[model samples]
Target: MKLLIMSDSHGWADEVVQVVDRHKHEVDELIHCGDSELQVDSKELSGVKTVKGNCDFGADFPEEIKETYGSLTLYVTHGHHYNVKMTYVPLSYRAEEVGANLVCFGHSHVADCFMEQGVLFINPGSMRLPRKPKEQTYVICDITDTEVEVSFYERVSGEKLTDLSRTYSR
Candidate 1:
């Protein structure tokens, strides 16, 4: 399965729509890790699974979500509740509780992906306000029985950042 993951748009609705439209046909699922600052019924978020972020005001959006795709299980959250800016320990425990093999979150606005305790954790960074590498970015994950290939992309240009691409054994 292929998944397009993005987060922390912080009100940049048009960019979100553009990114989704760019890869809609190639991906099996779309996920937004929150801080969208858009209403639950916003057209930009249509068909995208999303969670509530710290900046999100209403109760319409869920705090977290668990989804199963083929043989993979995904746990998605905004990460603030778990204190992800400091560490992944809390988030890791939650993922274990939910029986998820893939964890998707965004809080620090730093894109990264890694394997820990047999689980894969991904942070797609901020689409509007970026940090670290300073690139507004998102991620696309290609999953198979043996490994997962994660490719980062520039949010506005839809260009792949090959240097950040990684493949992890499952």
Candidate 2:
């Protein structure tokens, strides 16, 4: 399965749409980790699954989502409730409770991907307000039964961050 994940666009609707349109054909699912700042019904989120961020107002969005794609169970969230900026332990525990093979979240606006205790955790960062390494990134995860290849990309330019891409044994 191939999954495209993005987050914290914070209202860069056009860029979000462009990124999705560009990669929709190659991915099996599209996910938005939130702070999109667009209405839940907005066209920008038409075919994407999203969770609510700290900045998101109203109750239209869910705090988290558990979804299955083939053999992979994904735990998706916006990360603020779990205090992601300080640590990922809470989120990891939640993923364990949900029996997830992967966890996707965004709130710190810093792109990152790593494996811990057999679970893969990914944060696509903020396309609009990226921090730290500041690459304005998103992630395309290609999964198989034995391994996962994570490819990070620049949302605006659609260029892959080759150096940041990695493959993990499952």
Candidate 3:
């Protein structure tokens, strides 16, 4: 399966729509780590699996989500209660509690894709405002039977060559 991962959109539907439309065929599922700021019941966002960010108000959203996909356990959250803008400790602890094989979060607007203690941690950055100088970015995740290949892409230029691998096999 192919999944498009994004976060911290902050109500920029035009940019988000453009990115999804451009990569629509290439993605099987879309996941947002939070800060969409759209109407909670908006069907326009139905394609994206979203969490609630600190800025996300008046909506019903779970603080955390865990599910099984392929051969991996995925844990998704927005990281406000976890204090993601400050550190990764809270999230790391949550992973341990959930025994997650893959962890997805957003809050700091910094692109992060890496592995630690046999778990994949992904923060897809903010599509509205990227924290770094490169560009606003997201990730394309290809999951197979026992492996996951995550490729990062810059939204402005639409490049998918950057590989951010947090794991290879179970």
Candidate 4:
């Protein structure tokens, strides 16, 4: 299965819509890691799996989500509760408790991916106000029973960042 992951849109509805329309046909799942600032009834969020960030006010969205796809279990969160800006240790501990093989989170607005003690954690960065590398990024994760391949892409131009792409074996 392939999943499209993005976060921290911060009211950029047009970009979010563009991304959904661009990849809706190819990806099995679409995830927003929060700070979208869109209403629950908005068309942009129709089929998206989302969480609430610090900037999000309403309770319509959950703080975290746990979902199963094929044989993979995914845990999604906004990372503020766990203090992602300081360290991922807290979030990593939470993933262990949930028995998650994949953890998706955003809040730091820094795109990153890594594996720790058999669990994979990914942050797709902010599509609106990205920090660090500052490329307005998102992630495309291709998963199977034995491996996962992650490809990063630019939200505006839809260009892949091949240098940031990575594959991990299970």
* Top-lDDT candidate index: 1
Measured with C-alpha atoms, the lDDT of residue 91 in candidate 3 is 88
Task: Give per-residue CA lDDT, model 1, range 1-170, as digits (tens).
Answer: 99999999998888999999999999999999999999999999999999999888983899999988777999999999999989899999999999999999998899999899999999998999999669999999999999999999998788899988899998
Task: Give residue 130's error in model 2 in angstroms.
Answer: 0.3
In model 3, state the lDDT of residue 155. Answer: 82
Span of ten consecutive residues with least summed lDDT in model 1: 54-63
Backbone collision count in every prediction? 0, 0, 0, 0
- Best of the two (3, 4) by TM-score: 4
Off by over 4 Å in 3: 161-169
Better of 3 and 4 by lDDT: 4
Order candidates by lDDT, high to low: 1, 4, 2, 3
* Predicted candidate 3 versus true structure: per-residue lDDT over 103-124, tens digit per residue: 8998989887777888888888
TM-score of each: 0.97, 0.97, 0.89, 0.97
lDDT of 1 at 143: 97
For residues 124-153, write the lDDT of model 2, one tens digit per residue: 878889994577999999999899999999
